[model samples]
Target: MTDVLARRVQASPDATALVGVGGAEWTYRELDEHVERVAGRLAALGIAGEHLGCLLETRPATAVLVHAAARLGCVLVPLNTRLTPTELDSHVERAELAALVCGADTADTAVELSVDVPTASVDDTEHTEITVLDSVSPAEFAPASRDADDPAVMLATSGTTGEPKLVVLTTENLRSSAVASAFRLGITPDDRWLDPLAVYHMGGLAPIVRSALYGTTVVIPGEFDARATLNALERFDCTGISLVPTMLRRLLAAGSLADSLRFVLLGGAPASEELIERCEKRGVPVHPTYGMTETASQVATARPGEAFAHTGTVGRPLLDTDLSVLGGDGKSVDIGETGELVVSGPTVFAGYYGDPDATARAFSERGFHTGDVGHRDAGGRLWVTGRRDEMISTGGELVAPGEIARVLRSHPAIDDAGVVGLPDPDWGERVGALVVGDVTDAETVRNYCRERLAGFKLPRTIAFADELPRTASGTVARRVVRERLLDNGD
Candidate 1:
């Protein structure tokens, strides 16, 4: 395929491409210029065809760099800004990042994470004061011709064992995702999508890429404040948006959705049935989508009409995608039978970066094993149960119980720890911990973990025990821990 941004500029040069909620706007032509400028700066640092880590918040600059990295043949790795220096260092090393680009807010963290790699700073505002980029001119760079199969982005997802694994999505995968999403959601020239999710997430970055391809507009609301997002919806006259369950709940609590909205593409975490019913009653068009970072963005997305009728299903697979529910026998289960979800599509990611064993294990004869347990109806719609693994879904972020257990075990007084997700009305599931240690209070354990883990990964509740329940093979019995933690009650 031709350069995504360049092709968009050719088709709609003067069309509004990127808009800052109440700040600034850039046409496709203007965005192309900015992309060229950023691409040149990256080339000045000899960053072509290398993995580039971007530690940035959701803003226009990040969107510009997304296209710029594509133009320069760089595999963009969007770093989670909430991660601690210690946590981020491991990911940086694991991804083998060649260089790092940071916004002003993240410059210090970039310095800590890029000890072995080169780092640069960018002025995210309209004023273009760049650090490493200042020494180079746009005239010095030429856009590289990229193959469709070339790796475009590398995103980190937690493995079953709690280690961070990088998933590589190619150019074709992203393009196919955008096309499939448009077929389901429908795109228009006037469609302005207000995005509040972080660029580090596929949910956030997908709109930026999809908007370019469709020659529409993506509005950055800076961050997801319930009131601010609602105001932005009206202020920008946005037609569509993407949100996780928590954000949508907060928005419903704050105020009514804007009249200009057509659809809200909900994913990232499970949306409570109550939340979906509320939206349906309120005339809010909420589409429940089931996807992971591996699929670029969407696998199955229930449209507003289907959503109102079905209530819980995540709808049928996207166009050009195939999904199956597989039992322990490694065969497709009967309809309505709960089994592991397996997905096959043009949108499926290339593989986990630099890990052949993981790549092999992630796929089978049928398709990529999703590790999520769900059943499909006769209509082919998916109803998710829970994770086949022990990953916790709190808010929209996926937290590894093993990761939290590791941090708890690091404490001086703690002997052993077991972590699990407990059901909650608000956050889909909240992180709960069972500690076998000399901990007098829960705050002490939480305070210790706060230093080592991100806020979302920290346990919300702590229960003390003599020892953790373990299997005969000496592994912690996560189901028992979940049950026991629920029995203690926060």
Candidate 2:
């Protein structure tokens, strides 16, 4: 369990471990061999207990390095490839990375970092000065044995608000997440998960670890084109896939689902009821999940049956996990009460990386304060409303953006919606909305909402956009939406 690849190879030596669409394929044994080589390369760079930063995308190489870092006993910091050097400077310094690894595409960005950490490259096709410059034989290196509580990866939170925190994920967190997800989703030896997500995020990285633990296959696509992803699903005989709401919507528009597909794990953001209904109509097994980087991946997920039954719920908490909705008084609220969501479990991360104060503020007596506002139903299904900080105080009445966005999405003409609070002179804040669809105008959309919403809940101002800004995980970037609204003078 310490060296997951080594153990996986021991258990299932010939099982398919990784499938690079139109590229290379590796069995568990081969993958383990490659991982050991990569770990040897890192060891040659003098990367010992120091944290290692990986500025790479979702590719076969990145997947190998993930296990390589674990094998070397170096805590991994999966740097976001989308971030600029300036945006990444703080994270690089905060993590105090000892050595940085880059792929062919991101090698230049790694050079741009202000920090003076040793850098290496892993471009298999080219032989540059930094490209796999050193190597050690498998007999020369020994994989470090890691405990369950050992920090595995220091992953950054999806910065929806233009601010991100570094969360420390342990082996136990990843193990618990994989086990619970497998129990809920059902896994088989032939299961192949088609992954199109960025490896820097938990959604993408989890599958790399989970597939090894399950002794299954991970199909890595070159890039996320709707047609390409759809083709890969069929070509690789993939049974499962992970996607955000936006990706799901686009994939549904692309083509029919592969008959070999078993489940579509839809998470990273809240999916509208319309989207879920569409999945149901298409006979797609969409399992809407609720999770964050702090929990490794999924805290709760609604299996297809439960998802269809409870359209908006994220389903029950996973095995060994506990969820509670606490009010302003910092006490657990009654069932069906809207309050701040609190999560405490083995799957939950220990704390943020290098931010003790922030970590202290994030947890309460119960558990990690998720800062997400939601409630549990009588059936114990979790319904996440919105962020506790995102609540719009329109004339002192708190309005959850999700509630209004749900109503707006219900409109037949409206394709999607994003709601936020705008500063107002009269009221402390006014409810504002940005919508996408073929609606006639903002007023028509407002009229549609007027029937369903109360006066304060109705949007004070509305704007139209072809698309709203979204984070990588597909969550609506409300901070960006708010800035856009302000710029538009809405």
Candidate 3:
């Protein structure tokens, strides 16, 4: 297939391609020109067909680099801007990067990184040994003919449980994901998607690809400000949006959603019933989705109205995708029986980069082992229970933290909650909770959990906090919460 950008430009050169938070706009023709220019600069650096690390925020330049890499057949490695210099260095080494690209926000860190790659700065500011990306200009060149199986982008896992692994996605994988999403979400020619997610993550990267493929517009904010996002939704007449649960909560609290917004793709973490109820009551269309970096972006996504009816169900697997609930014996479990959720499809990632053994271990006869625990109902809908590794074994009874966290979040006063296993002498591990809410009374929270959860599943100790620690994608950072509990001797 032709490069998505080239195809989009051919189909509608005058259509709105991108809208920056600062009111900057780019038509398809203009965006394609910028991509070619960036591709030219990359070729000038002699980094074509190499692994290019991008440490940039959600801006037009970042989008340009993403497509430029595809045009040049270079593997785009989007580095998380939130990572420390040490973390960035480790990732660069692990990915075997040939060059690094930095925008204004990450220039200093790019310069500070220990990697010896040829670093290029998008901003006008000069770094001692970095090349200015804007200075180089070359004759336009045709987009490279990339095979469907050629790796297009490499993303690192959240690394909440262990060291982050690089997941390499091919051109076909991304394309399949984009197409499946459009079919599931009902894409239109004039659809505009609002993207406020970090550009490094799959949640952010997929939208750019989806918009390009659909010949639609994507509005990206400079940063995720609730009020700013609301304004952009109305101003851009965005037909769709991607957001985490926290972002949705803030937007709902700030004001009403615009009628122009048709669907809100909520993922990055599970959405609670309370949060879903709030959106339903406010006339906000929210589709709770289930997916991971390994599956491109979304494997299963509920329709907005269906999500409102089903509450926590993430819907069924998308067309061309297969999902199964497998037990410990690697066999399919009965319906409504909880097990590890495994997925298989064209959209599934190739494997971990440079780690054949790990990749082999990640896949079973069924497909890619998601490491997530969920169950399928008789209606064919999937319900996420928790992570396989995150189950708490207290007093020899296994308990899913998500089950308790869901109940805790149902409390009228609780805004957010994270459950983890704490070290204990009597029990192997004790159930513990960190809650974010207006309620200061820990006893009241515990009593609320007592009403809904089993005795063993109930949080042995509950701590109230103004907010819970979350990863860049907005999932409650269980490791961070566990560390806080350990540090406080709770």
Candidate 4:
């Protein structure tokens, strides 16, 4: 792994390696030197092809460390910066991280975790010790090469589903994801990608892998600032950018993006057709994609409109990935029938780290048993339904709030909608919606949805607001909404 990847850097020393937040830049030559130095540090601390943990911001240094770790054959565990100190500590202990590194911003919290490992402050580390941005031959000490089967990332649960569980992914898993993404949205040498999504999440971390593999320039925003991302697009003359549906809607609604861009990858959360159409109408090349942390990044994406158009479809699977809709009996469902979307591919994660029971539960011998419910059309395009656990049962009827939200979005007056299940004595659970836009238009919007949605599926109640609750990964927090609605006695 280190030999091949490091040679690539050495072969193109003069090439611009990367550019990121806080006014940082690195050419291939400089990046090679930096990686070697950092690898030296890791080796000096006896951290080899073992687990090395990190809590850092999105910056040039973070990218350098990733490359360095790969060279050192060390398993990289990126701790969520947003997690509490206790949460961070638990992950470190779970990964058995013998050495940890943190940026100046997160060092205190890392310390609070009481990690027995040697910890270093990356941000405050003296830059003069070796070289800041200078060309040097790659270090002589090369770590053992890791095949596609070797673990590259060890991700833990976010506690959204009880306690966090570890998800270990191999190099092949990440490479396959990067490869699939590049195929979906044709990677170009001249293309510069902007990723403002959180680094701790798969949504954000995937970009680093994608760019490194492709030798493409990725312009990373320090954080997810809508305006800052907009500014960078103009400033860097960036060509391609990845965004969640929430960010794309915000950017489009902001109406400040330039039209010079080629492709804007929209994923991380399901989006209304209205949002996708708006992006297309704005002359912004929009490709709606679908992916999860378990799948690396993207599994499918709408192909440049060369493919047939369908409402709410995430498009067909890219090369080398197989997808099927399976019924409750673990058999394939008809094309139009809804079932659990099962995926088996090189990109699938190895197993849940340290949790054999969870690992067994998450993956079948055939493929990953994704709890995500979806259906595949005759043309092979995948359309995601709501999660099985999130499905609402009302009066002996099964209702998916995502279906209602999609219908509500068709209303011209409705900006955004998030549907949930609310307690109802008569119907066990009634459908409710939290919408963004004028509450006065709720009646007209309800009428609009009535045209397409069945009576049992139409929301019985709607709470209008300026925005809906969102998670770091860009998904609307349905459980959070349930809690809020319960607290409000809605």
Per TM-score, the best of the predicted structures is 3
Off by over 4 Å in 2: 124-139, 471-474
The lDDT leader among the candidates is 3
Q: Which stretches of candidate 3 lie over 4 Å from their true place?
A: 139-142, 487-490
Least lDDT summed over 10 consecutive residues: which range in candidate 3?
A: 481-490
Which of candidates 1 and 3 reaches a greater TM-score? 3
Clashing pairs in 1: none
Query: What does the lDDT come to for candidate 1?
Result: 0.84
* Candidate with the larger TM-score of 1 and 4: 4
Q: Model 3 compared with the native: what TM-score? A: 0.97
Ranking according to lDDT, highest score first: 3, 2, 1, 4
Per-model RMSD to reference: 10.2, 1.9, 1.5, 3.5
lDDT of 3: 0.88
Q: Residues 397-459, candidate 2, lDDT per residue (tens digit)?
A: 999998999899889888888999999999999999988888747778778888999989998
Candidate 3 to native Cα RMSD, angstroms: 1.5
Query: What value of lDDT does candidate 4 attain over all alpha carbons?
Result: 0.75
Which of candidates 1 and 4 is the stronger one according to lDDT?
A: 1
Q: Give the TM-score comparing model 4 with the true structure, all chains together.
A: 0.91
